[model samples]
Target: MKKGFILIEMAIVVAILGILLSISYINFTRLSVKSNVDSKADEIASMLRDTYENGNKEMNFKDYYIEIIKNGNSFEVSLISHKNSVRKTDLKDFELNIVGQTFESSPKYIYFSPNGEVFLSNEKIEEGYDYNIDDKKFSDIVIKKGEKISKKIHIDDMPLGNITVD
Candidate 1:
């Protein structure tokens, strides 16, 4: 009398476990990518805020790139580290995403009038005028998991003009 399954039955169970494990692994990888992208977006936003606060007023958007690299469970942002004034991390192949660009038809850049009010309809950069961080400089960068790595992030602010950044 046998109390256990046959060898053939055990082999079938092993195959089923293998399939399940593979599926779980694939799902985990996808989730990891989503998490990494979100973290990168938040980090970039913080950096922009800090730059704005430092009185670094420039009408032109500072072009920057975001790199995602493989190392371990955690991901890192690659850039020139200010303190060390050197490349922050030695990275392998990464997908570069563009961060800043000002469009003519877009209100991505807001100028301030002489009276300290935000010039609503002006398109040209005024002389001696600086960027007001309070004006809410927007970005259009988007990060996602899979083939589409980046896209313009848009937000609707109308009946007022929309807030957009890239």
Candidate 2:
């Protein structure tokens, strides 16, 4: 009788272990994907900062494009290619939670300057950053001096593609 009771206890323990292992495996897979996406965002941010540093004064604003996308919990940043080619390496990085839906709107922008600034519509401005409050117009972000600069062009009509900034 004692042997029989021990055998039943072992069976129950094995079942619980199997359940725990399955849950852990599922969670691990999800976490891995989320981490990869987050890491990509960080890379993109760094590239933008570098671009601003390199060309705030010397290069033409038309030469570069910065694209940001908010998809649920994941985000992607990329540089618009010169020929409008969407190369995998051209994508800056993936970010997580850069913009929340609670905010007034989502912005996918390009920054012409090394300071990581872009020209956005007045209605899109929410908090922080600089803008013309009265007219709802935003001037280009300057690192030190104030100037009217243009950086973003809206192409929402185009679907998400190499040239599209949606």
Candidate 3:
């Protein structure tokens, strides 16, 4: 019955605190990763929507091309009227499923028409292909940070694409 904690009691208290801190740190790391992945997914989905809207609304640009490059974990957008930009993200290894087709190494393209439609393609879009796309189509863009964390963005088959994140 001492007035202060003995050596063994102090050691036990320190051990318990260390364990709790370790657990909290691990959980915090996991949550941070999840947050990063989710935000990256949302950014990609929003980029697609913005590209479509900009293409349709801007009268000067004949067409806007959004080319996805998985190697760089980035996408570049270009317009016929010389407007071009690129977006780079921290996430990588995106699994893009378009019309049941998987795009891995090769690049993919989603071009918007001033006519108010969006189309996906494997090759670089050409002038002739602008108006050749049929009715709207559905596509999925899966953004992944690693093996464990991921988010799915669905682009529905509607004019200008109806995008949803899950």
* Highest-scoring model, lDDT: 3
* Candidate with the greatest TM-score versus the true structure: 3
Tens-place lDDT per residue, model 1, 4-71, is 89999999999999999999998898777655655555554444343232223332222222233435
Cα lDDT, all candidates: 0.40, 0.40, 0.63
Mind giving the per-residue lDDT tens digits that candidate 2 earns over 57-78?
Answer: 4554444555555555434455
Off by over 4 Å in 1: 56-138, 148-166
Residue pairs that clash (backbone atoms under 3 angstroms), model 1 = 138-165, 139-165, 139-166, 140-153, 140-165, 140-166
- Per-residue accuracy of model 3 over 35-125 as CA lDDT, tens digit each: 8778877877777777766666664223455666665654432332233565544344444445555566456667665565556677765
- lDDT: the better of candidates 2 and 3: 3
Ranking by lDDT: 3, 1, 2
Tell me model 2's lDDT, rounded to 2 decimals: 0.40
Model 1 vs. true fold: TM: 0.47
Q: What is residue 123's positional error in candidate 1, in angstroms?
A: 20
Clashing residue pairs in candidate 2 (N, C-alpha, C atoms within 3 angstroms):
40-93, 40-94, 41-93, 41-94, 41-95, 44-92, 44-93, 52-114, 53-114
Predict model 3's lDDT versus the native.
Answer: 0.63
Per-residue error for 25 in candidate 1, Å, reads 0.7
Error of 1 at 56 (Å): 8.1
